[model samples]
Target: MIKTLLFDFGDVFINLDKAATFRELKKLGLEDFSSGMMEQNQLYEMGKISSEEFVNFYISKIPESNSKKLIIAWNSILLDFPQHRLEFLQQLKEENKYQLILLSNTNDLHISWIKENVSFFTEFKSCFDAFYLSHEINFRKPNADIYEFVLEKHQLQPNEVLFIDDTQENTEAAKSLGIHTWNIDPNTEDVVDLFSTKSELF
Candidate 1:
């Protein structure tokens, strides 16, 4: 029985233009990251790298002006999170169907931007029994440990939780531990669509 719902916050809720962000950075001369940056990015997601270190590492490779421009361009991908998603989550909270927990890989800058722009963040997050973030927990997805941490922390059996994320590899990691999962593609799948479709799912 699925008693809990574990959600990933990035592309599942907020739109992420990763490809566009990297392209913008390259245009501004942040070259080193052009090839192997995701490897370093995995470190960030794993909390192996500090936000400052992550930014500085990239900035170190670019000219001063281009570095500043790259930072602006990179950070600009964080767009608005619409209220409809929040409303959907809120409705689920009202239904009291499952214990909601959110697990996300995020950083200080992305968070700071949300606090400044997404006013419903607090309310939306309140719906969750636990809200886990990589930077806050010093752990991340695609690592078996993080999945284990959540499962054990919540005393949740893998079959009792459904993990929703936009990343395939991350979902696979959760599935390895027996958790149910959904790889939400915002372009194709709306979270609201899940509630109806998943009624008889489990």
Candidate 2:
């Protein structure tokens, strides 16, 4: 039986324009995102580097871009957190049907923007029994270590955990560890439909 639920923050809850950041960077003259740049992003997401260093890495690449502009461009992917999702999450929390845990691959800047812009962020956070952010935890999704960390930390059996994420790779990785997974398509799937869509699990 599924005794615990793990959720991804972006796309699953807060809406994101996955292409916005790339488009925004292109406007700032970043025509190509090099492998080095990608590595830096992963490092930043893992909290292996400071925010100052992250911004500086961009500034060093695009000398004309300032910290403020870089930050704005980086946060372009983030969008509003819909109220309906928040309500659904709150209802689940109140039901106390499962151990609700939030596992998100997020960085400091993105989270800071959400905290500043999403008015219900704190209330949404309160719905989860444990919240793990990639940067804060020094680990990220699609990585087995992070999944192992969550299972070990919560003392949960992998078979008893249900993980829901928008990314197929993430869900697949979790499934490999014996966890039940929902590789949801954010464009069509609404988390509120959990009961009807995955009724068998519940």
Candidate 3:
């Protein structure tokens, strides 16, 4: 029986333009993501570096861009959080049938933007029994250690937890650890239809 519902944040609850960052960077004269920049991004996401350091890294590469411009470009990926999705999650929380947990691979900058833009951010977070953000936890998805951390922390049997993420690689990683997963397609599928879409699990 599935006792826990593990969810991803971006492309799952909130809408994200995955390519928006690169497109916005192009406008800032950043032709493409360099190997160093990508490495720095991973470090930033894992909370190894501060936001100021993150912005400085970008500024070092793109001398013409200021901190404000870099921040805007970096945060362009975040879009909207549909009200229907929040309602669905809130209703699910009220049902109290399963333990709802949010596990997201996100950086501080992106989260800050969401807090500012998404009016119901706190309510959305309150729906989760436990919330784990990558930067806060210093662990990222698609890594066995991160999965192990969550499983160990909750004393949850992998078989009894269903991990839902938009990325196939992330879901695949969880599956390797014997966790159930749904590699949701944000384009055609909405999380609000979870029960109808994956009814057998429930």
Candidate 4:
């Protein structure tokens, strides 16, 4: 009796070139992110640091790179949002079978870019009953606290919510808390085939 559908944003709805950012950053003379930079990334994702601070950190590291170039390189990972996925979500919303909630590990810059570029971003957002972004909530996936926050906030039973994410670690974390999950592979699995792929649960 799944009463809720919890979804991830990137690699689930919108396409992403996961390696694009690193590739772009390499052009800016950043060969790799040090441990501190990785920590800063998580901090930025959780909204602990402002976007200005984020860009400044990169600029400080790569003196030759300007703010504009750093921002562009950071956003290079985001690609397209296919229309068919939106239609499938719209149909699901119309059916009103289960509560749809979007739980995404996203930062401010990425979201701002989507808002400006994705024409149907508003419509896509409207489909969800509750939308939770990592930066807004100060909680990112693969963290038990974030899952607990969502479950507690929604007053949902862990067993009744199906969490879908492209990352195995995220899905596994949810599953540990008694939630159902689909550890989808973006390379082969399309979210539009949810029912067919997880038929028994449906």
Candidate 5:
């Protein structure tokens, strides 16, 4: 029986424009996303570096761009959080049917933006039994260690967990460990129809 539900935050719960960051950076004259920049991002997501350092890294690259401009560009990917999804999550929490957990590969700047913009961020977070952010946990998705960390931390059997993510790479990694997965396409699907869509699992 699936007793635990592991969910990805972006694109699964909150809407995100995965391309918005690249586009925004281009506008800032960063025509190419260099390997160094990518490495810095992963480091930031893993909490290996502080937010000030992360912002400074970009600032050093584009000396004309200040911290505020870089932060706004970095946070351009986040979009609106739909009310219906929050309602759906609340109902699921009230039912107490599954041990809901949220796992996301996020950094400080993005989360800071969300906390400031999303009015019900706290309420939505309260629905989860555990909330694991990449920066806090020192791990990110598509990495086997991260998945193992969650399973071991919760003392959960891989077979008893249903991992839902918008990224195929993430879902596939979880599946390799015997967890059930749903690679949700946010454009065509709404998490509110979980029961109707994944009825067999329920």
Candidate 6:
């Protein structure tokens, strides 16, 4: 039986712009056009450094950009939380029908930004039996080891866990481990749609 429902935070709970950072970088003149600096980001997510350090690193790469503006743009992926999704997750939590877990590959600054801006961060987070972040666990998505960490740590059966993520590669990684997955397209699928589809799975 499926006893756990694992959700990805970014697109599942909150909305984010995929291109916001790229646009912001152009404005800041980052010079290096690498996609999302995932390496440095992984370091920050692992709790190896502070958000200030992460922001400063990016700022230093920009020659004469406003640090504050660059910081905000870098954080622009975090958008407003849609109410229906929160309500759905809240209902699931109240029912206590499954082991709810939230797993996201996010970093310190992004986390700090959400903590300060998302009014329901505490309440929403409280709903999860385990809230796992790559930085916190020193693991990130698209890496099989992180999935192994969760399975081993929680003593969870991969078949019993359903992972939801906006990114296909991450979902594919989970699928490789025999975990069921839903690749949610934020521009298309809404969490409310997940209710019917997932219910059928059970």
User: RMSD of each candidate?
Assistant: 2.0, 0.6, 0.6, 0.5, 0.8, 1.8
lDDT (tens digit, per residue) of candidate 6 on 8-112: 999888999878887878777865655566666667777777777877777767867766887788898788988878889889999999899888888877888
* Pairs that collide, model 6: 45-135, 46-135
- C-alpha-based local distance difference test score of model 3: 0.95
Index of the highest-lDDT prediction? 4
Local lDDT at 2 for model 5: 87
Residue 65 in candidate 4, Cα distance off native in Å: 0.1
- Lowest-scoring 10 consecutive residues by lDDT in candidate 1? 62-71
Return the lDDT, model 1, position 100.
91
Error of 4 at 118 (Å): 0.3
Per-candidate clash tally: 0, 0, 0, 0, 0, 2
lDDT of 2 by residue, 1-202 (tens): 9899999999999999999998988888788899999999999999999999999999899888899999999999999888999999999999899999999999999999999999999999999999999999999999999999999998999989999999999999999999999999999998889878889987
lDDT by residue for model 1 over 1-202, one digit each (tens)? 7889899988777777767776777677656454457777777766778777877777766655444565567677787687898988999899998999999988766777777878888998899989998888878888899999998898888988888998999999998889888888878887777766566656
User: How well does each candidate superpose onto the true structure, as a TM-score?
Assistant: 0.90, 0.99, 0.99, 0.99, 0.98, 0.92
Across residues 1-202, which tens digit of lDDT does each residue of candidate 3 receive?
9999999999999999999999998888898898988899999999999999999989988989999999999999999999999999999999999999999999999999999999999999999999999999999988999999999999999999999999999999999999999999999999999989989998
On lDDT, the stronger of 3 and 5 is 3
Score candidate 5 by TM-score against the native: 0.98
> CA shift at 27, candidate 5, in angstroms?
0.9
Error of 5 at 154 (Å): 1.0
Candidate ordering by lDDT (highest first): 4, 3, 2, 5, 6, 1
Show where candidate 1 strays beyond 4 Å.
32-36, 66-68
Q: After superposing candidate 3, which stretches have Cα over 4 Å from the reference?
A: none
lDDT of each: 0.81, 0.95, 0.95, 0.97, 0.93, 0.84
Worst 10 residues of 3 by lDDT: 29-38
The per-residue C-alpha lDDT of model 3 at residue 101 equals 93
Estimate the lDDT of model 2. 0.95
Residue 173 displacement (Å), model 5: 0.4
